[model samples]
Target chain A: MTVSVDEIGNLFARREGTQRDAAPVLIGSHLDTQPEGGRFDGVYGVLAALELVRALNDADIATGKPIEIVSWTNEEGARFTPAMLGSAVFTGVTSLEEALAKQDAQGITLADALAQSGYRGTRAVRFQAVDSYFEAHIEQGPVLEANGTTIGVVTGGQAIRWLDVTVTGVAAHAGTTPMPYRKDAYFAAAQMALELEKIAERRAPRALVTIGQASIANASRNTIAGKVAFTVDLRHHDDNEVDAMERDLRAAFASAAKTRGVEVSIETYWRSPATPFAPSCVALVAQAVDALGYSNERIVSGAGHDAIHLARYCPTAMVFIPCVDGLSHNEAEDALPEDVTRGANVLLNAVLARAGVAATLNAK
Target chain B: MTVSVDEIGNLFARREGTQRDAAPVLIGSHLDTQPEGGRFDGVYGVLAALELVRALNDADIATGKPIEIVSWTNEEGARFTPAMLGSAVFTGVTSLEEALAKQDAQGITLADALAQSGYRGTRAVRFQAVDSYFEAHIEQGPVLEANGTTIGVVTGGQAIRWLDVTVTGVAAHAGTTPMPYRKDAYFAAAQMALELEKIAERRAPRALVTIGQASIANASRNTIAGKVAFTVDLRHHDDNEVDAMERDLRAAFASAAKTRGVEVSIETYWRSPATPFAPSCVALVAQAVDALGYSNERIVSGAGHDAIHLARYCPTAMVFIPCVDGLSHNEAEDALPEDVTRGANVLLNAVLARAGVAATLNAK
Candidate 1:
């Protein structure tokens, strides 16, 4: 195994080919886990890619294009946030300096952690040198298993928008202040939450709206809430639909605040636009699954992955194997070995198609 | 000034009279201040009571019954919660043991704090020997000031009920979970809040409903909220009305949770029944206000005071003077000197009527 580390600590294992200058076909995922992470999440994808390289070696197959297995860093983002940092930086979506400067909860910078862990390297990773990318991962939701499918040919990732909402109202004695005199912040916030649910309902199966974090300042059991702040996460497959959803949420909040005699401010914090895989790459992955005679279906990724970042710079697709109950980022996550083997086979064949088997060409 | 401390830290200063067996008239309020308290909230009432005694002594006017002034402890409850601990114990609303056991955020108990401050005493303060009680305070609301009134003869205090609510839903990925599948806790909580406000509006002019504190566990910016806990405070002058308000709030919350397919639990944390002072005592206070030739009005106390506890056991009344903009419990709180003097005169006359002038009786 030939291994190299990039400046941001991405580990790349390359298997040499007949032509070194020919762009390599990249296959990999991240190598991080959530606080209560399962063993198979990021680790499964990395191991599967490594197994693909081993199987090709066992078959005595050399390709025109080199094979590289990558292990991205901080994709879970539980320790250091803004996930998929390694791939984002490699593709130039984020600067290497910024990713290195990112700090964890303990205030330890990424660069410091890499240096301390002895993974810091001078080698630079270039996305332009990657001919194509394929990743194999466990489905983090109940979609595949519930449908009794063994494989999921991921077509694209959903659009994501994060909004920060602040509701300002008059704080008064809960026992003394009459309803007419109150500009209760919680009341306005509650109305906004309810209205957001309604908006999501109107959009139906494609909409995913959630209120995750909420808090009020000077909170007490008896005083009226004066100010409340919460986070809203809206997701959809279409970028225009996601934008419309945000507009609806803002308008609803404005109306609710006005009716309650409160003030509200909604700020869009971060956004990830929908990333659709190249049709040819998606078809190739699906064809591999069909040729292997695996139960499979087309699906969209509910969660972000390194593939989403790589998709922006090159043709990319992902193969998903069913996880037990689709539970992920949790310690209780489990998967069957047979499914893992099937996923690896599909990944190997898909990579072989892109890299072009040199032995087969010589034989011909 | 013969000052003595009680076992629970109440400060009593007695002025002896010819008939020591006669029940003494009690006059005063608490001396504690809020964290961001004004100089004139409880302090004004206390100083006014002390000044009233000084004026009577300077004029050589003695009463038939003994006169005593008390300074209640922990009225603000900012440091140790469940305010009015001293008065509540004095009137038997809360047991002395419970009051002593109540701890602050720092885990310091009331008994420990009093002992550390050297305020704990061996003297046993008895409310049975008290003939009547009068408290002079600044109106902490805009009703009197907005109406251009100088003094308010407080008739009674409003009833207060504190309820705790918890909403439980399913936590899932914001980008993957469809609207139909999500049992969003924040949505249920928000709907309940909005409905509660509407319920209060239905009972408007008297209902005082508020949601003070709210929180979601394991909250993140992208995941759906799994659980939300909040406090609801409802108050009214009519005990039956407050009960109905509680019923309405519970029903609304139950319905909202059911609609959202979420679980909810409502707990009643605390309750203070409405206390109406004796008609005779209220009339005497109004008479004193009229005799002082001040622009006065009969008003109900929206906030809890030491008088409410005392009212349960004896004839108790309160004299309120207008504060600038009716702002209290804030460092920016202010009141005109004339208003203070006017309230003091009204309190003096009321106490004189109850205590009876010994010199005038001797002359007769």
Candidate 2:
């Protein structure tokens, strides 16, 4: 096994295959997590990948294709704008120069950060042929645990749309302004938020909506809110459904503004289309779960992962184990030890299935 | 005319009475205004009082009781808190020591500010006997403008209550959390805001409710809101009604939180009871408006004023004129020239009716 770090700061641990010329099977996830994130989020995936390699070594297994465990950089984007910088660059989805130029809040470029952290390497930051990629991560959601499942065979990543909404009214004295005359912006925004929830509910199990960031401009306890700005996050497994949800969101916000006699503007600031994992890779994960006799379900990744970028260039899929309360990007994020081990086992078998075992020795 | 400033920085201009020892009729308002306030709000009242003295001098009229035009310090609390500090101290509602100790955002005490501005005086800050108190100012509301009335005989300052409300829930991934499982704090807060508006509407025309300040804790565009804090401002003419409104507010908020599976807490941070003006003073202003034959209506001062404190110890009334769109405490606040003149005329006659004219000479 040899360890190396790519120029884009992706850490790779490679185990040579018996048939060295064959393309390697990659198994890993990101290492970076949010500032306030729980330890299990991105770390779980990376550690699980490392554990898979250790388990294979203990079994004295050799494969036809080499296996590389990778830990991608800046997956959380907590300190930068674009996330999954390492994977995006590795897959040619984002150029190395572009990723390196991305700056954090303090204006420190990714290149500067990599150099300062002693992680920048001379290895090329571009994609090469790979047999397949498998990632093991804590299922940062309640679906698996609520269903009493141990393994999630992730088929794809969900479609996501981000919106910036502004509601404008007129500021006046809270005491002086009568109800009939007020065009309160916060009130309009509140109504719009509820409407967004209703829209998501209509689409049920698959649709998700969040009004996460909100603020009243020039807020004062004795003055009416004149302007309010908020962020809306909408997600669905299907691109078409997400698009429809966006339409519903805009229409509902417009109606709410009209009813309140305020002006509303909706801007779709970002969009990430649903990423469908390679059928063969997904099948491998499903087969592994079934062969292991673990309680399992087919699911879509609700949050973005390094595999989303990898899926565009190579066959890729993910294995998920439930975290406590479906919480992530929070300090309280937790996963059961048994479930974590089960997820790593799934990843090991899935990678072995894709990489085709060439020889096996007696267990150490 | 003699000009002097009190230790509390209240500016006073005295017009000697024919009978030297009679208690003076005091007429004026504050000179302080909000940071973003219009030129008219506090300045209008002070200038109107000065205008009354000029008009009386133009007609060479002498009253039995001396008249004093006063401009109170820090009436807006835009610089120092506990608004109407000068009058509060004068009326003994607040001590001079307390007023001086109040500080601005920069930690500069009111005493320091007065000293720096060379306005603080050796004269005592406490109030003395007076025939009556009269103030003329912009209506700071839409009522007079909406009704096309020229004069507003202010009956009293409105009852005011401020509440801080917090809603708590669990934070989860926006994309992963199902609608049924999300106890979204922002959604619950939004519902509570709408409910507050509904509650106020049930009490109609006189009742006013505002969710002036609101914020979600640890807000993220893609994370379910875990907690939300907001301020509610409730006002009415009757103190009992305002108290009832508070009860309705608490019940509604609790219900909304319960419906959303969140926890809610409401705290009444501040309360200022209704200060009804003396009926005799109110009638004097009404009589003056009628004698001038300008369209008039009896209205309550929706916003606080120096007169509220004075009403507690002396006969106090405020004369109001329409400001454009009922706007004040904003750069765009405006009032018509004719309305300003009309308001001052009402002030003049109201003061004359309260302090009897002892002598009159032919108009130069």
Candidate 3:
């Protein structure tokens, strides 16, 4: 997941005793790392499954149900964006061509990256054949380690709302116009942004409001700003807070417009209600962790993942292991091989428990 | 000063005489209005000078400096920025060629407009030969008119500074990257822009801050703003206020940057300090008003004008007229012909008070 988002070169390692069967349970984390990120996040998830395959092979016994381990591409969005690039496409939230055509900052398209990285495949969305999907990852946050838990059985991820604010102002000769004589736009926008922080502060803890993007029109050092636009990303576990905050934020903006003499337009660009882990998937994941003799404390996932997108189509679950000092998607991302093995052990047994799933050894 | 900024038409009038002494004391304002606009601004100023010329002619004062009235081109800079086009060129702030070469929003150059207008002038900067420059304009504010004053003597005009803020952020897909997971540039910029009002507010009652231009990289409704840039115009009559606001604003920006993982760059494109009117010119103006038995008040010109530039070389003064409701630069801008006549009277007297200004003799 570096500069180029194409050609995700991912390899699958199946247990020697594993066999391909209908309705296989798919399990593995993305193989890519966050740019300048933690090593164990996506990589550890895949490695854990591979370790499961290796350990299972040693047992010399093939379960009736088959399981497959595969690593998806562009999970961290380091080189490519819309993170979880593979899963979003797999679930049909995004089209393959669209995903492949997505461009990076350098103007390199995902299709071009695929050709460059040699990871392009004709295979259909993985969810089409899988009975269930499971991802093992390192918890990017310190919640797991702080609680002294060996693993985190994520209950679900939080809901997110992305807002884009575009404020329009007449472009004027800055030097010729005086302060009180002219209508200034950036002033109103800036005030609103600060007010949003105050709103966030009031909402505190649950309502996380971030002013991520700010922009201006015909922006020159010498001209009065003709337009001002920005982005507000607000996440909340509760939908009402999201709704309320949106209203409050909008009201604040409207008032600002009346006072500042500039026109403002806002659009809700994206919205995703928080999706909790399905109870069945949560229970199965817990059972697998218990079978492996590891502690399973639940925590909320602060970040989005492919599982969230896949939730739209099939039941999905995520397993998190501790990366070194709870760091992921960083250059310092590291984890012990044993921890990777332990997480994979749980993943292996969990996949095996699912009915109608099979171990796969398909010839390419 | 329409779209064809270069061609404002021919400049001429009855000199009343043909000799050097017949050249009237030139008095008038620009014909152009700001593009987005306000009325009774430039247009009224010119009408005031013309009304004064008519009154002088009607009175049959053939020996007095024969008054000439004019309407300069591209004053408000609606089509072409850097307002006061004709005046600036005359003052040598920039060359006529440069002004003519300036481009409009449609990317058409001023040279193109000049060709269309057929108004290319052969005259060079005539600061030495020209008589006193007097302009009558609206108060544009409630300062004097509210006090029931009929005339205002401008002591000086405030300085102005224009800036462009360019923020570099990593553009990523808004959907795939969790709000927390992505380094959204627009968000950070939002914080910067939103805080602008607070920046100005902290200095309260004096500091002026505006963000007029805002833009983003890969500006899609569903994309995390990666690269954002905007313009900020900070203006103040008090240099300390401008300095202090800038320092504090930059610090707040740094704080936001530290909190949000984004890079920001601010480039100062324009800076001009406040210019004070000449005491001698101011005295001459006050005399004109006092001699006419008109109400008088000394005030700061709320806007920049040709008088500001001309003041550097020769004596420049501004007379005041009221816009019905103190509105200028709007489509509804209005000023009565009587007010225009009053302003002209002040301008004519001020010019005549200066010795050696030979208009009738020059004409003969």
Clashes of each: 0, 0, 62
Worst 10 residues of 2 chain A by lDDT: A355-364
What TM-score does candidate 1 get on C-alpha atoms? 0.94
* Cα misplacement distance, residue B176 of candidate 3 (Å): 11
User: Which candidate do you rate higher for DockQ, 1 or 2?
Assistant: 2
RMSD of each: 2.6, 1.5, 7.5
lDDT of 2: 0.90
Supply candidate 1's per-residue lDDT for A97: 90
Worst 10 residues of 3 chain A by lDDT: A1-10
Query: Which regions of candidate 2 are displaced past 4 Å?
Result: A361-364, B361-364
Between prediction 2 and prediction 3, the one with superior TM-score is: 2
Worst 10 residues of 3 chain B by lDDT: B1-10
Model 3 lDDT at residue A53: 59
lDDT of 2 by residue, B1-364 (tens): 8999999999999999887998889999987888888989989989998989998888899888999999998899887887888999989999889889998999999889999999988878776887789998898889999999999999999999999999999888888888888899999998998899888889998999888899999888888999999999999999999999999888888888888899999998999999999999999999999999999999999899899989998999999999998988889999999999899889999999888898885655
* Candidate with better lDDT, 2 vs 3: 2
Higher-DockQ candidate of 1 and 3: 1
TM-score of chain B of each: 0.95, 0.97, 0.80
